[model samples]
Target: MPSNDNTPRADRQELAYLPVPFPKAPPKEPRFAALRTWWQEAWEEDGVLRAMWEDVLSAPEDGFRYMAPWLRAVLMVAGVSFIVLMAKAAGEVVLEGLHQLLTAVPKVQVGGDTSSGVFAVVDQPVRTYIAQHSAGLPVAASTVYTLWLLTGITGLVLGYLSRNNGVRAMWAGWGAASVFMVWTATPATSRPIAVGLAVLAWTVLSAFAMRGLTLRRRVGRPARPARVSVKPEIHVHVPAPAPAPVVEQHPHSGCPFRD
Candidate 1:
C-alpha cells in the first residue's frame, strides 16, 4: 500500500460528478411561487371564492334594522287575531252546547198540570241524563259551566290588556277546569270538543305571551342621531359674447366700395 501522505484527498475532487450515494442537491426549495399561481387559477375557474367575497363585502352592518320591527309587528297582529279567533270558536262551539244543556233544565216540568208547578212535572229523561252524567263531574255541571264562563271573561280581559301575567293565570284556571272535566265527567259526546277548546285556548295564550317577550327584545335601544353636512351653492357669471368679429380694414374697405 502507498504511504499515508500519498492518499487521494476526498474534498479536492468535485462531489457532484463523483458517484456519491447521498441525495443530489439537498432538495430544491419547493416551487411555492408556482403553487400560489396554480391556486389562484383554480379559484378563478370555480368563481365560488369571488362570489363569497362579494357577498361578504355587500352584506349590511345592521342586518336586523328593518327585519326586527317588521317581524315584531307581524307577530303582534297575528297573536291578537289568533286570540280573537279562538275566543269566537270557543263561544260558538263549546258555550253553545252548554247553553242548550241549560235550556233543557227549564223545559223540564214536574207534572202535566201547569198549576202542578215546574218541579212537580220535571222531564224524567232530562233529569235522568243529568243524574247519570253530572255525578261523574268533580263539581256540579252548573259549577263547571260557571268556572268556564269565568275563564273566558278573564282571558278576554288579559288579552285586551296584553298582560302576560293575567293571561297565564287564566290559563291555569282553565287547565284545572279541563282536567276536572276529564276526571269526573263520563265521556259525553261533547267531551272531545270541550277538550279541544281548552287546548286551543291554552296554546294561544302561551304563544301570545312568548311573542310579547320576543317583541320587547327585538325593539332594542334607540338609534344615535346622524350628522349631516350641507354644501354652499356656487354661482358662475358668464361674460357676454364678443360683438360679431370686426373685419378691421377689410370691413372699412367693403363699406367704402358700397358707398
Candidate 2:
C-alpha cells in the first residue's frame, strides 16, 4: 500500500528492533503455586504427611536398650562384607571386559601394590587378558584393590549415619556395602561359607533397608521448626467521648437528670 504521508514509503516503514512478543507466552504459571498446592494437600486431614506428624507427636519416647549389642555389631559387619563380595561377583559377570578396560586407565587403578594378596589370585586370567589384549595400557593391580576398599569403608560409614535405629542401620549398612563391593570382588569358589552367609544377610538386610528408606524418610529427617504465625491486630479509637452527654439544667429544682 502506498503511504499517504509525504515521506517515502521506505523511510516511513516502522523498524522492529525489539523482540516481538511471543504469543503472550500462555501466561506462565507461578513457580511457588505448585509448592503451595503441595503444602495444602499434604496438610489435609487424611494426608500421609499429616498422619506421620500425628504419629510422631503421639509416639512415646523410649530409653535405648543394648540388647545383644555385641552380636548385632558382629552381624552388621559380616553382612556388609558379604554384600560387598556379592557385588564384586555380579560386577565380574556384568562388567566382564569393561572391568579390565577400566584398569587400563590410571585413575581406575584399584591398588598401587598388586604383586601379592587378593589381587594376585583374583582375576589373574582376566588380568593377563587385559594386559595382552590392550595396546600398551599400564595396569596397577593394587590401585583397583585400594579403590574398592575405600568405597566399602565410605559406604559403611554412610549407611551407619543414615539410620538411627540399630536394626535399620544394620540393613542400611549392608545395602550400602553391596554398592561398593561391585568394584572389588571376582567370582570364585574360595570362601564359599562366607559367600553363603552374605547371600542370607543381603536378603534379610536389604529387604528391611528398602522399607526403611522408602517409608521412613521423614522419620530420619530433622524436626521442622514450629511455624510462628503473626496475626495482625486491629485497633479503633472513638474521638474524645463526645463531651460526656451534657446534662440539661432542671427548671424545677437543683437536681440534674441521671438517665
Candidate 3:
C-alpha cells in the first residue's frame, strides 16, 4: 500500500487540478431606460416646465408648510366676502321688488266718502312718496354695490401684489363705508338686522386688517436670536484614597509596621 501522507498529497494535487466554476456576473440591473425616456419627454424645454421641475427639485422638505397659515387666511376671507356680497345683492333685489309692489297699489282719496278714515290721510302720501322715490332705491344700492365690488377687486389685487398694507387699509375703509350705507338706507324695522350685519362685517374686516398690520410690523422687526439648548455637566466620582493601611506593632516594641 502507498504511504498515507503520499496518498493524501496525491489527492490534494488532483483536487487542485480540477477546473473551478466561477460565478456568472449578476444580470445587469433591470434598466430604467424607459422611465428615463418618459421623464425626458414630459419635462421638455418650456420655461413653465423648467420652472416646475426646479420648484419640485428645490422645494423644502416640508413642502410649503410655512405658507399653510397664510393660505388658510386667504381662503377664509374669500369665502366670507363671497357670501356677504351675495346676501347683500339678494337683499337689494328683494327690497327693489317690494318697492315695485308698493308703487303698483292704487292711490286712496282722503277726507272724502271713499276715504278709509285717518289712515288714508296719514299713510297715503307717505306710501306715494316712498313709491315714487323708490326708483332711487336701486341707484343708492348700485352705488354702494359698485363701490364695494371695486374695493374688493382692489384689495384682491393688492393682496396678490404683496401690498398687504394697502389691502388692509382698504378693507378698513370699505368696511366702514358699508356700515354707513346700511345705516343710512335700511328702515327702522329692518335697521336692527342691517346694523347687526354691518357691524359684524366691519368687525371682521377690521380685525383681519389689524392682524395684517400686526403681521407686517412683526415682519419689519428684527428676528430674535434662537435659544441654544444647554446640557447638564456630568461629574465623575473618584474613590477616596483607601484609608491608610492599618499598622501593627509588637506588644513590647512600639515600632509600627503595615500588616
Candidate 4:
C-alpha cells in the first residue's frame, strides 16, 4: 500500500531508516504456579514417588543386627567403591566440567550458521546425560539432592533385601550413602574414622545393598500349577449300637426291671 503522506517512499522503504517500530514483546509473566497447583495435584498420581518416599522413611535396623558379619565386610567394601564413584562423578561433572563449560561458552562466537558452528565446545565433555543436572541446578542444591537421592535409594533397597525379608539384600545400599557422604566431606587422607563410622550406625543398618540383577536374566517364568495330592477318603462305617432289646412289659407281671 502506498503511503498517504510521505516525504519520500524510498526513505520509508529503507527498513533500517523506517519508523516501523520493532515489536516490543509484552513483559513476560514470570510467575511460578507451583504453590497454587502443587498441593492440589500432589495426590493425583504419585504412586511411584510415594513408594520411594516410604522406602526412604522406612530405613531398616542399624548396625550388626542388620546383617551377618560376613555381609558387613562386603557392605563396607561396596560402600568404599560407591563413595569413590560418587566423588569421581562429582569432581568431573560439577567442578571440572563446569569450569570447562563456562570457559568455552564465553569464548564462543554468538553465531549459529555454516559460517560459525559449534566444534570442540569442550573436549569430550559428556556423551551422555550423566551428571548433566549440574549445569541447570545450583551447585549446593544439586549436592544436597545427590545426598538425599543416595540415601533414599539405600533405604528403599535395604527395606526390600531382607527376602523381598530374603529379598535378603542390604549392608551395601543402606550405608553406602552415609559412607559416600563421609568420604566426600572428609577425604580418607584426612579422616579415616569417618569412613569406619559410616560403615556402621549403631546396632542396626549393617547391610548396604547389592546386585540381584542376576535374577533378571530369566523373563518368562511360567507358573507351575499347584499339585494337591488328595488321598481317597477312607470311610470306616461303624454300625450304630443295636437298640437294647426291650423286654415286653407284661401288663400282669409289673416288674420294673423287665423293661
Candidate 2 has its poorest 10 consecutive residues by lDDT at 59-68
TM-score of every candidate? 0.25, 0.23, 0.27, 0.22
Give all candidates' CA lDDT scores.
0.55, 0.54, 0.57, 0.49
Q: Which residue window of length 10 is worst by lDDT in model 1?
A: 118-127
lDDT of 1 by residue, 103-187 (tens): 6544433222333333212222222334456667665644544445466566655755675765756656655655454434424
Ranking by lDDT: 3, 1, 2, 4
The TM-score of candidate 2 is: 0.23
Model 1, TM vs. native: 0.25
Higher-ranked by TM-score: 2 or 3: 3
lDDT per residue for candidate 3 within 56-175, as digits (tens), equals 555454355543454446657999999999999999999998577445433432212342553333223333333344465644423333344567666655654564776767766766
- Winning model by lDDT: 3
Tell me the tens digit of each residue's lDDT in model 2 across 1-259.
Answer: 9756766566466767978877655878989999889889998998768876765554434212433444446657999999999999998887876666456546543322344644344334334333333444454544444444444445445445564466465545544454324223434554454344445655554553444455535557688999999999998986775556768778899989854
Best by TM-score: 3
Runs off by more than 4 Å, candidate 4: 1-143, 146-162, 165-171, 187-190, 207-259
- List residue ranges in candidate 1 displaced over 4 A: 1-144, 183-197, 201-219, 222-259
For residue 46, model 1's alpha carbon misses the true position, in angstroms, by: 99
